[model samples]
Target: MDIPAALGGVSTALTIVKQLNDIDRRVDEAGFKLRIAEATSALAEAKLGLVDAQEDIRSKEAEISSLRSLLKRKEETVERSGYRYRCDANKNPIGTALCPVCMDEGRFVLTIQSDQSGRPYVCPKCKANFGYLSAFQDP
Candidate 1:
């Protein structure tokens, strides 16, 4: 379970194997039994590690599913708030329809013309017009 306990088990197994080897040097049947027992305990430890790895995989999958759902909820909220939404960049407005610059998505707006450039660009939020600078100056 804990590191210290795990290490302790390993130490015990090694000690048993070493004692069995000493007995083997003296040519006895009891040493063979000790070796078999130690090998069985090591196999059990390997099975426990396999189980822990499986649990870790399941935990990570659950976390991924939760994050996916959260992202979906946020995307729906943004759409409901009337932000211009477009997964693609090259979509042209239907008829004179345009997206509000505030929303930045190409939805729910009347068709509008670009500035003197005669291009087609609408604000994401209001879909009125998209411009970086006003044509008028106070100075």
Candidate 2:
């Protein structure tokens, strides 16, 4: 479930713990006279259960915090990397002068295709030969 739902569950657990503590005190004061030993034991057990529930809520909250941190980091990385755009011949950018491949703009098509990969690749759609950009060094 989402973070908000998990937080709500944690809140519910806290409320239950508070109620259990109140019950324990009431039972000790009133039920003690009727069944002193049994009431004491039951109250002790309920307190232990409440402690376990509290631990569960803490762990769930920690996990949500960790996930939020990871997402924030990924978003930062995408923002830093400028997109690569493709250009065509005549020094014009491809697809509205936008590099459809890397989504970068303001780049003219490299005069010659790169072949740094040492292998010829054909475009699957146009059957045209293209080289790897790594092979072409910036002039």
**lDDT of each residue in 1-139, candidate 2, tens digit only:** 2344444545555555555565666546664343445445555555666667678778989978976775553333221123222333343323211122322221223223224444653333333454432222222
Candidate achieving the largest lDDT: 1
Off by over 4 Å in 2: 1-34, 79-139
Positional deviation of residue 120's Cα in model 1 after best superposition, in angstroms: 39
Query: What would you estimate as the lDDT of candidate 2?
Result: 0.42
Candidate 1 residue-wise lDDT, 1-139, digit = tens: 2444455566666776667656754576766876868766965675565566667778889978977775553354323123323222233212332244422332334334455576655544464655332221112
Candidate 1 error regions (>4 Å): 1-26, 79-139
